[model samples]
Target: MIASVAFRNFKALRETSLILAPFNLVIGPNGSGKTSLIQAMVQLRALARLPLRELMPDDERHPEGAEITFRFQPPFDGLEASLSCVSESLCDFLQVTPLSTGGGVDDWVGLRARLLSLKSYRFNHEAIASTSALKDGGELAPDGVNLAAVLFTLRNTNPNIFECFKAELLRIQPEYDEITLIEQADHTIALGLRLAEGAEVVPSDNLAQGTLYLLAILALAFDPEPPAIVCIEEIDRGIHPRLLREIRDLLYRLSYPASTGDTRPSVQVVATTHSPYLLDLFRDHPEEVVITEKHGRTAHFTRLSDRADLAALLEDGSLGDLWFSGILGGVPDEQ
Candidate 1:
């Protein structure tokens, strides 16, 4: 997991740093660098795994002299990677340096693998409902376009994990008796839901928007080959407010596997949200919530747990109420 991230000249980030927890919920008004921060992490992942030319078309890249630095916690303590853009043109070239002298080439390789394992998702309702062509199993796409294929692969390869994923969905929406994957004559695949033991399978296209989103998330949480770090944008979208708690628990399950008694390695999760309902869920875990504020041209981040008078502040109202009332810094300024 990343202990902290510092970046300069990256979109609204300008020059800012944020201390992160295993599972983080970033809340703020629009354009306050919430998305920018996640993009910065994604950029770092690209830097670690892809060619510089491949990243040239990225909008998050600064023209020149922009840099990002990461400080990781153990078992990666004292290991840091810094990437600086050294080119003057839009074709920015990155120079990466590992600051840990004690770590060997194997350590660097491990770091690269971890970075390669990072996956950022911004699920689209329509994309999640669309049919997917059959292909070799891979990570869920950023837009979740391949959710069906991914689930299909999981069901075929790892039935245990797939069963867990199905159980999670059923818990969330008990109306579904079973989760199914239908393979069409064209070899394309679509997600199906069985309303009863003997009921006909309903295709994903007929599923509600929120059901698709929930299934996509459960699939990610129970993925056999889960990413080391998962970044999600608008995590609360397309779901009922009542299900936010379940959503929170699933994300926490990714980072806090011990809480569920799962033996799998924990995954670090960072999610962005504008929903105050979701923010309230993290009230007990203030360290896991970061508030973003954009002042002038620079964006700033503050962990809610870092507040000195949090006890007194909670007295005013619930965390969501306080934030919505503008008592919290994440609210928008009326200029």
Candidate 2:
């Protein structure tokens, strides 16, 4: 599990650090650096897993090596590992490389785009990939394409798990009972997601924007060995308020263990949401609610549990109104 993270000049963060918990709420308005934080993690994790040489970097001045650190604890045995790297791909195109060019600045000059992306996560450093995103030196595509590869890998190594997930899909979509991977005569493999509800599985790409959004959310959130620390943007996007608690509970169960006989890894979720209904789901446990906004470029993560009068506001059924009205004291009061 990731104990904490500190980022400097990475995307929207000029310099910020936070103590990470198992289940956190990174609530903030859009563009308040919420996605940037998660993006920073994605890039850092990618670099740690993929060698800097395989990626294409767009910058050369900052050098993608401003230094990133990770303080992490592994699962099951609680093994510890750490990693830090020059922004990957940034130096891949530097003038020194055959396909790269140098910039005016030398110190981290290669990290121009994405603001140097100087960040880190805690993990086993040597496990860092020697050439690509696969933690093991095997060839694999970047994360944008990592999902499918991951499914295939899981299928081959853990057929039981894959079969279980397939059965789950069937249970969730009784009408689309048939799901599998097929390869045409051309040797191109494809996912056949069929829906039996008189509805077609339509492949993930052909899904309605709403369905696509929900599918992506589940895909990322339901991993077997989920990330130690995770941050999600607009937790309620394309999802109905009625499903907020259900999904929240799903995510929560994914993050922490319950009384089940089977053991699973721990996952921490940090999500930003605007739905009061989402907040209301945690009424019994106030600590999960975090409210945030920007003071110019700075992000303020506030705990709503600190407010003594929140119960009354919740009683009035104006959770959203109270939040925006500054009674919860997350965002700045409008003039």
What tens digits encode model 1's per-residue C-alpha lDDT throughout 73-147?
666655766666653211134444445453432465677788888999999979988889888347888888989
Error of 1 at 310 (Å): 1.1
| Candidate 2 lDDT tens digits, 1-335 | 45555555444444556555667666556666666656655655454444334323445345444323333332211211222334531211212122123222232222322223222222111211111222321222222233334445556676776676666545544556665454436433344467777656555444444433443344444455554555666667656677666567656765665533336756667677766667667766567676665666666445567678777768876655666565665564344
Write down the TM-score of every candidate.
Answer: 0.90, 0.61
lDDT of 2 at 224: 59
Provide backbone clash counts, one per model. 0, 34
Best by lDDT: 1
